[model samples]
Target: MKLATISVGGRPTPAVALGSGRFVDLSREGGLPSTLLGLVRGWDAHRGAVERLVAAGTAEIGPEGVRVLAPIPRPERNIMCVGKNYYDHAHEFHGSGFDSSGGAQAVPEVPVIFTKAPSAVIGPGEPIPAWRDPTGTLDYEVELAVVIGRGGSGISKADAYGHVFGYTILNDATARALQRKHQQWFLGKSIDGFCPMGPAIVTADEIPDVAAMRVSTRVNGELRQDARVADLIFDIPTLIETISALVTLEPGDIIATGTPAGVGLGFDPPKYLKPGDVVTLEITGLGTLENPVGGRPA
Candidate 1:
C-alpha cells in the first residue's frame, strides 16, 4: 500500500492512500505507536499494523492535490549516495580525476560513496535554496534511492534484499567547482536544500523489480537525465551488503544509487541551476519529487 506523511490542520501526521483519491490518518489508530524510524526499526513487527490499518478501512484518502510532506522528515542521519555506478557515467568522468581514467578509466572494484547532510533534505514541493556562490554552477543528478526497512550490520549480499523497506527518488544537487576545489564531494553536496526526496515511500511488496525501473530528470519541463536502474554496476543488494559491512544500516536510512549519464556537467558547455529553475525527479514506480530553485531565505 502507498503511505505518506501529510499535514492537515497544521499537525503533521502519517497517512495511507485509499482508492478514489482518499487518505486515512494512521495516527488516528493510536498514533503510529512509535516514531517513523521506530516503525522501520521494528518493521517486521509493525508491518502487520500498517496492513491491518489499511485493511480495516481506517485510512482517509483525499484529493491528489492535498499537500504531501517528506515521508520521513528529519531522519536521524545524513543520506548516503553512491557515485559513478553506471558504465557510461564512469566513462564520462573517466579522466576528470573523480573517475579512474579521469575520463577513460575502468570501473572501480567497489562503489564510491558519499553523504549528504540531513540538513540538506527538502520535502516534495519544497523550495531548493540557490547557493550564494557566484560561480552559478548548480547541477542535478537524478537517482533511484533505496530505503532501509530494517536495521542490520554486516548484512550479506545474499541476504540484503530482506533489509530493504522500499524505494524513492533523489535529486543529488551539486556545486561542481566546490567539488573540484576541495578534492572532496561532501562540501559540494551538503548545501542546505540540495537533497529533494519523496512524495511517499512505496513499500517493498509493491515494487517487485527494483532493477528494471526507468529513472529520469526534468529541469523546468526539459528532460535532462534519462536511464534505467538496470544500468547500475553495483545493484541494490550489493550496495546494501557493502555499506552494511562498514556501518549499521538503520531503518529510514536512504541510499541513493548513482545517477546515469546526461548530467549537465557532462555537457560541453555545462549547464547549471539558477534561481527560478524547477527540477523534477521521477522513478518508474516511485512518485515524482519537484523543487524550485531560489536564493537563501531573506
Candidate 2:
C-alpha cells in the first residue's frame, strides 16, 4: 500500500493513495497523523491493520482536499546516503575534478556512506533553494530510498529485504563546489532544502521485485541521469549488511541506494542547475519527484 502524510482539515493525517491523484484520510477526526516515523515504530504490531484498511477501500480524502507532506516530514535522524555506488556515476564525478578520492575507478570494496541532516528534507514539488552560495554548483542525484521497518544491527543480506517497510524517490540535490572545498560531503550535501523526498512511501508488500527498477533524473525537461537499480555495484543487501555491522539500522532510517550516471557533472562542460530550472527525479513505482530551482532569498 502507498502511505503518505497529508494535511486535511487543518491537521496532518495518515493517508493511503487512491491512485487518481487522491488519498484516503486515515486519521481520526480533528487530529494530526501519527507521523510516518511513528507508524513505522509500531509497524510490527500494526502492519496487518494498515493493510486491512487499504484492502477495504476505507479512504476519505482526495488531492484537492489536503496538503501532502514528505512521508516522513521530520526524520528522527540523519538520512543514510550511499556514494559512488554506481560505476558510471563514480567515473563521471571523478572526471568532474570535484572528486577527492583519486578517481571514481577507486570503487570501494565497501559502500561509501554519508549522512544528510534531517532538516534538509523537503516534500515533493517543493522549491530547491539556491542556498545563498552563488559560486556554488548545484546538481541532482535521483535515488531509490529504502525506509527501514524493524531496527536492528548486524543484519545479513539474505534478510535485509525483510527489514524494509517501503520505498520512495529522493533528489539528493547537491552543491558541488563546497563538497570539494570542505573535503567532506556533509557541508555541501547537508544544506537546508537539499533533500527532496516523497510523493508516498509504497510499502514493501507492494513492491516484490525491487531491484530491477529503473532510476532517472531530468532537468528542465531534459533527461540527465538514467540507470537500472540492478546496476548498483554493491546492491542493497550488501549495503545493509555492511552498515548494520557497524551501527544499528533503526526504523525510519532511510538508505539512499545511490544515483546512476548522467548527472550534470557527467557532461564535458559540466551543466549546473540555475534559477527557474525544474528538476524531476523518478524511480520505478515510487513516482516522480519534481522541484523548481529558486534563487537565494534576497
Candidate 3:
C-alpha cells in the first residue's frame, strides 16, 4: 500500500493513497495510528489497518485542498546517507575533487557513509532554496530512501530486508563549493530544504524485490542522471547490516542509498543548479519527487 502524511483541516493526517491524486485519511480510522511515524513504530500491528482502509475505500479525498507532506515530516534524527555507493558516482565524485574521499576514485570495500540533517528534508514540490555562499554551485543526487520499520542492532545482511517498512524517493541536494570548503559533508549537504523526498512511500509488499528497480533524475526537462538500482556497489542489505553493526536501526529511521553517476558535478565545467530550475527524481516503485530551485542572493 502507498502511504503518506498530508494536511487536512489544518492538521497532519496519516494517509493511504487512493489513486489519481487522491488519498484516504487513515487518521480518521478509529484506533489507527495518527502519523506515519506512529504507524511505522507499530507497523507490524498497524499494517492490517492501512490495508483494510484501502480495501474498504473509505474517507477518500482529493489533493485540491490538501498538502502532501514527507512520509516522515520530521524524522526522529539525522538521515543515514550512503555516499559514493555507486561505482561510476564514486569515480566521478573523486574526479570532481570535492569528494571527502581523499581523492580516491575506487569502489569502496565498505560503504562510504554520511549523515544529512533531518531538517534538510522537504516534501515533494517544495523549492530547493539556493545557498548564500558564492560559487553557489548547488547539485542534486537522486537516491532511493529506505525507511526502517523495526528497531534492531547487529542485523545480518540476510535479515536486512525484513527490517524495512517501505521506500521513498529522495533528492540529496548539495552545495558543491561548501562541500570542498568544509572538508566534510554535513554542512554542505544539510542546508535547509536540500533533501526533497516523497510523493508517497510504497510499502515493501508492493516492491518485494527492490534491486530490479531503476533510479533516474532530470533537471527541468533534461535528463541528468540515470542508473539501475541493481548497480549499487553496497546494496541495501549490505548497507543495513553495515550501519546496524554500529548504531541501532529504529522505526522511521531513513537511509538514502546514494546516487548513481550523472550528478551536476559530473559534467564538463559542472552543470550546477540555478534559481528556477526544476529537478525531478524518480525510482521505479516510488513516485517522482520534483522540486524547483528557489531564489537566493549570490
Candidate 4:
C-alpha cells in the first residue's frame, strides 16, 4: 500500500493511494490511527483495517483540493545519512577535493554515517532554499531513503529487511562550501529545506527486490544521476547492521542510503543550483519527488 500524509480542510490527514492521483483519507475512517507515523507504529494491528478500507474504496477523493505532504512531515530525530556509499560517488567526491572525512581511500572500510537535522525536511513540490548557501554552491544528491518500521538495537544484517516498513525518495541537498569549511557534513547538510522527500511511501511488501530498483535524478529535463540500487557499495543490510549496532532504530526513523555519482561537484565546471532550477528525483516503486530552487537575491 502507498501511504501518504495530505492536507484536507487545512489539517494534515493520513491517506492511502487508490492510484491515478486518488487517495482514501484514513483519518475519516474511525478506529484507525490518525497519522502515518501512528499507523506505521501499529502496522501489524492496523494493516487489515487499512487494507479493508482500500478495498472498500468509498469516499475516495481526487487530487483537486488535497495537497500531498511528506509521509513523515517532521521526523522525531535527526535523519541518519550515509555519505559516499556508491563507489563512483565515493571516488568522485574524493577527487572533488571537498571530502573532509579523510582517508586517501575512495571507498570507506565501513559506512560513513552522519545526520541531517529534522528541521531540514520538506515535502514534495516545495521549494529548496538554495539562497541559504552564502557561498552559492547548492548541490543535489538523490538517494533512496529507508523508513524503519520495527524499532531495535543490535539488529543483524540477516534481520534487517524484517524491520523495514517502506521506502521513499530523499534529496540530500547540500552546500559545497559549507561542507568544505566544516570538514564534516552535519552543518552543510542540515540547512532548512535542504531535505526534500516523498510523494508517498510504498510499503516494503510491494517491493519484491530492493536491489533491482533504479534511482535517478534529473535537473530540469536533463538526467544527471542514474544508477541501480544494486550498485550500492554498502548495501541496505550492511548499513542497517552498522547503524543499529550503535543507535536504536525506531518506526518512522529514516536512513538515506547515499547517492550515486554525477552530483554537481563531480562535474568539471560544477553545476550548482540557482533560483528557478527544478530537481526531480525518482526511485522505481517509490514515487518521484520534485522541488524547485527558490529564495533568489535581488
Number of the top TM-score candidate: 4
TM-score of each: 0.91, 0.94, 0.96, 0.98
Candidate 1 lDDT, 144-219, residue by residue in tens: 8888987799999889988888887888888877777777789888887778878777888899888779999888
Deviating ranges (above 4 Å) for candidate 4: none
- Kindly report which residue pairs in candidate 4 clash with one another: none
Model 3 C-alpha lDDT per residue in residues 176-199, reported as the tens digit of each score: 888889898888889888888898
Number of clashing pairs per prediction, in order: 19, 0, 0, 0
The local lDDT score (0 to 100) that residue 110 gets in candidate 1 is 81
TM-score of 2: 0.94
Candidate 3 lands at a TM-score of 0.96
Predictions: Cα RMSD each? 2.4, 2.0, 1.6, 1.1
Candidate 4 lands at a TM-score of: 0.98
231-266 per-residue lDDT for model 2 (tens digits): 998888898999899989998999988888898777
Model 2 local distance difference test score = 0.84
Question: Which of the two candidates, 1 or 4, achieves a greater TM-score against the reference?
Answer: 4
Query: Highest lDDT: which candidate?
Result: 4
* Alpha carbon lDDT of each predicted model: 0.80, 0.84, 0.88, 0.93
Ranking by TM-score: 4, 3, 2, 1
RMSD (CA, Å), candidate 4 to true, equals 1.1
Report the poorest 10 consecutive residues by lDDT, candidate 3. Answer: 99-108
